[model samples]
Target: MNAIQIKNVTKRYKNVAALHDVSFSFESGKIYGFLGRNGAGKSTLINIIANRIFADSGEILIDDLPAKENIKVHEKIFCMSEADLYDAGLKVKDLFKWINRFYDSFDLDKAFEIAGKFNLDTNKKFKALSKGYQSIFKLTVALSLMVPYVIFDEPVLGLDANHRELFYDLLLKDFQHNERTIIIATHLIEEVANIIEEVVLIDQGKVLLQDHVSTLMEMGYSIYGPAKEVDAYCADKNIIGYDELGNLKIAYVLGEKTPLPKNSNLSASAMNLQKLFVKLTEKGGI
Candidate 1:
């Protein structure tokens, strides 16, 4: 079943259109990558889904019911946005307690378990923790909430390499143990590439592409050869992007079974989510 459904949702800030007729459905028990560059409306879309902001027009449904201003609907969703929601004066343990009260599915034991893994001091106030630890605390709360749907907007912003890997590991493990829809918005596309089952590319307040990760990669092909030869070979194909280095050139083309020049070296390449996202959002529209 679709955990959330958005239909013709539009949000505007005076003259600027933050989101334009955005429509999509997020299914249950799948990990989705909400990808885009800076100012691509990824955060705006997520905020709307979280019901933290109201859309100028259109409807959003959680569990097939309108979600706006619905406390019950909001209870089932957890959003760990870049914006800090914890009180700076509150101790880590106190913050967890507050969250536990707010979220029905919150597991205090799980939160403490994750915190222990990170070596976070429960007695430290939120403001006293380092940036990385702050993020870890937020992640701990979100993960332990075990809500039906979790939306993480750049949750790994200040995490180090070790913690980043740990976060992904915990996310996958939690998903396997408890079925829930997870939508993660992050610039670290390569790190989560293998874990995500689906990809959603949003640009300029619109969704450019949404597809299974494997299927999308299958449609991408790369050609590498002499600069001029690569260009000539990709002339007729729909090239998503390319790079030129001295006499060598590599071009990424999107298609299913396209003829290539015999002189050029062509191979079916797996698309890097980061590279594909950069190419698609570079033009602003897609």
Candidate 2:
């Protein structure tokens, strides 16, 4: 069953249109990469899905029921964003206890385990932790909430490399054991590329593309050789973007299956999510 469905959703702020007729459905037990450039409405869509904000027009359904302020739907979904949601004066331990009491599916033991892994000090006040630790605290809560759907908006924002890898590993382990739907909206596409099964690319508050990663990669190719040779070979194709350095020219092209000429280095290349996002949203058309 679809976990969440958004139909013709639109949001406006004064003279600006934040979202324009956005529609999409999210399935259960899959990791989705919600990608877009800055000001592309990733956070806006996520907030609507979390029911934290109301759309100006259209509707949102969670499990076939209207999701607005529904306690059942709220219990099944958890959203963690960059905005601080905890009480600044509360100690870490107090925050944990409060969350445990509030969330029906909260796992205190798992929360403690995650806190230990991150070396978080429960005695410290919420405002006392470093920026990275603050993010770590929020991540631990999201993981231990054990909700059916977890939406993370740049969860690893202030984390270092080691902690970031650890977060991914822990997230993967939890997914394997709990089988929940995870939606990650972030600019760090390449970091989570391997873990994300499907991708939803948005631009100007509208979805540009949504498909399985493997299928999307099959529609694009990268070729590299002498500048003149590579240019000649890609002459008839839609060259999305390219780069040239000295005698070498690497070009990104989207087309059907075709044979490469001899004397040119040619191979089917995997599409980088970051590059694909830039190419699709750069000119305001996908």
Candidate 3:
């Protein structure tokens, strides 16, 4: 299959299991929101796929080729992670040149073009760039890659609002022109809600859910009304969490929403992606 398939992948650090029997696939030619809260094993999974770390059990396959330390699949995938893997003294343009030579799929001209769009100073050393500009440089490199599968772990970290929006716009434009599998591992769910076609949510080192964004949105909703009335309406529903404001309450729920009782005070509203993610991953009982 032309996809990144992970089968029964398990990873442990002494007593802690970063991932446990996790199985899922990121299909070809789609933008996926790889979402999870902190310590949800997102980074662990990405590292494994990028061949930075090995899984204790199972395997990672990119289009049926093993990804673990395999050079053949290296050109097929690119992971732009939070870690600084570049030399600090290298100028932005020099680093781009280096990466261009390292990866057959990298486009040097497009990398420079993207840097221009972000107003990134290609002449400046990486260490001299501000935190936000550093992120811009990284984004530039990732956007220019012509690889089939690209994994972006916090791709917009330290970016300002304007630059972030520009990145999103450029990303969409790029995807529209040349379709590929884009796995965006990010915390800003709302920012990516419209960008991602599918979502794979992980929690507590396990796969919580993986579905089309539209379907997940359709399945999640909130019921709002007086505390007692809302509670009553949610009694038979799949309530995930709740919120209260004085006498009023809001119940975040999964499953199809039914019409409220005739003339009842209860009201239903669609749950946004971020809210749904928060409720689903919150640690305590709700």
Candidate 4:
């Protein structure tokens, strides 16, 4: 296992800066949630890491080695995304064979086992499988790799409820058994919140915050009670967001939770990841 560092990485699309000097490190043997809203440069950063696209400035290093079209670096990391990479003329089984040829540690038997579990037919051509099945096949391929890092971009893109749950279970099992670095970039914050150890929240084209999930969760708490009391309690504190209905109120406060006044009706509870994400991402709302 090795660490991947994105040092002052910057990318542009004509005038729009996709990634604006983004810098972060993904440690070994942990799962990281690369989160952001639509057009938030999450995909740009992922693509740069995979060497699918180049960053106009800065560097990406894997274990201190430059990852600029470096074969060794590429071998250590595998990205399974929505980009259709498989040959449409080849069957799923054939594609697996081709992938096995490229990756020496690719477990063919395990891939087939996962395929059977996902109810994906191996004999079907790439173009013949449904969207969900295609996602299942790619996810199976990702699970079968014996690399140090595995990245999933929209991993459960078209998966149903049961399959999504099963995939999460299997992914947790795989991570526990092999202990590799897994980075999942997805919009489903609530689903992967518990699975990831660290959080990287990006907005617009820059990183908003990056820290341990527990630490971020501790940074804020939700206070609820009567509307006036809640509003008064949050006035001096760092208020991230709030919700009000008639006389009821809930205010999410960042920084530190202040002591309530004597005989106050306000109560405080830990804020959830989804709520935090919503509060932080809202434009000019928080």
Candidate 5:
């Protein structure tokens, strides 16, 4: 299969397990929202995939080929990490030149073009740019590369609302032009809710769920009404979390939503991506 398959990958720091038997695939020609809470092993798994760190057990495969320390895999994947991995002393343009020299698939013209769109001063040393601009610079390089699988770890970090929107717009436009696997590991779930076709939610160093955005949207909903009615309606349902206000109650549930009892006072409302994420991660369940 043309995908990045993570097979029973495990990582630990001394006694703490960063990832435990993590197995999933980032299939080709799709955009994935890799959602996870802080310290949920998102970065650890990403680092393993990028070969920046080694997994304690198991392995990662990119398009059926071994991913770790493989030069061929280097051309197949690009990871835009939260940490700055570039030479701070080098000017942005110079760094672009260096990346161009390294990756045969990198488009130098597109890099400059994106830099222009972001108003990134290519002449400034990487260390001289502001935090947000530094993120822009890194994404600029990632966007310029036409690798089969690209991972963006917190791509919008430090970016203001306007810049973030611009980045999403540009990303969608880029994806529309060229289809590939784009894995976005970010906590800003609602921001990429619409952009992502699928969601791979991780919690407490383990995958909580992996489903299509539409399926999750359909399966996750809230039942609201009098506490008694809500409780009655939610009985035997996959209730993930809940909220209450005096006599009223709201049950956040996962699974096929059924119609309310005939003319019942209870109501079913669709749960948004952010709400679903919060509810599931809060309860770490169903």
Candidate 6:
């Protein structure tokens, strides 16, 4: 297969399982949102794929080739990790030159162009750049790489509003141009909700769900009305949970079959991506 297949991969740290028999695939030419809460195995999974860390069991394959310790497979995947991999003293321009040499397909001119757009001073050393500018520089490098698969771990970290907007705009433009597999591991679900075609949700070292965002949204909804009316409406439905305020209530129901509430005053609306995520991953009973 051409997809990045992660087959029953597992990783653990002491007694804590970072990834528990997790299996998922990133198909070619699609944007995916890799979502999870803190310590939910997002970084662990990224590290295993990037060969920065090894899985205790199972394997990861790219186009049928094993990924662990395989240089050829790593060539096809580029992960801009959250950790700083660059030397702080290296000048931005020199770092670009080094990257061009390492990755033959890297577009130096394009990287420079993006740097200019972000007002990133290429002459300055990496340590001299602001936090936001550091992210911008890394994003510029990732965007310039002409690779088959690109995994961005917190790509928008430390970026301001304007820069974040520009980053997403450029990311879409780049994806449209190349149509490669782009996986964004981020906490800002609402920001990337519309951009991502698919969602892979992980919680406590396990995949809770993986599906099309639109389909997932369609599978769940919110019903609002009086407490008694809401309870009656959700009685037969699959209620994930609900909120109560005075005499009013809002119940979150899952599944496609939604009949009209018996009471006319009751109202219902489709669940958005953020709401669905929270409902699924909340620690306490929801």
| Candidate number with greatest TM-score | 2
- 1 against 2, candidate with superior TM-score: 2
Instruction: Using lDDT, give the best candidate's number.
Output: 3
Q: Name every residue pair that clashes in candidate 5.
A: none
- Residue-wise C-alpha lDDT for candidate 4, range 1-286, written one tens digit per residue: 3699999998999999999998989999989999989999998999999999999999999989999999988999999988998898899999999999999989999999999999899999989999999899999999999999999999998899899999999999999899999999988887887899998888888999999999988878889999988877877887767788889998888877778888999788876677788878999735
Using lDDT, rank the candidates from best to worst: 3, 5, 4, 6, 2, 1
Clashes of 4: 0
Work out the TM-score per prediction: 0.85, 0.88, 0.86, 0.85, 0.85, 0.85
Question: Model 2 over residues 142-178: C-alpha lDDT tens digits?
Answer: 9999789899899998899999999999999999988
The segments of candidate 4 whose C-alpha lies over 4 angstroms from its true place after superposition are: 221-270
Alpha-carbon lDDT of model 6: 0.89
The reply for model 1, stretches above 4 Å from the true place, is 221-269, 284-286
The segments of candidate 2 whose C-alpha lies over 4 angstroms from its true place after superposition are 223-238, 242-251, 256-268, 284-286
Report the C-alpha displacement of residue 114, candidate 6, in angstroms. 1.2
- Whichever of 3 and 6 has more lDDT, that candidate is 3
Q: Candidate 4 — worst ten consecutive residues by lDDT sum?
A: 277-286
Clashes of each: 0, 0, 0, 0, 0, 0
**Once all C-alphas are superposed, what RMSD does model 3 give against the true structure?**
3.3
- Tens-place lDDT per residue, model 1, 1-286, is 5579989999999899989999999888899998887887988888888888899999899999899999889888989988886789999999989988877799999999999998899999999999899889988988999689999888888899999999999999999999899999999998999999998888888888999999877867677777877777777888777878888877877776567666556544566566667777675523
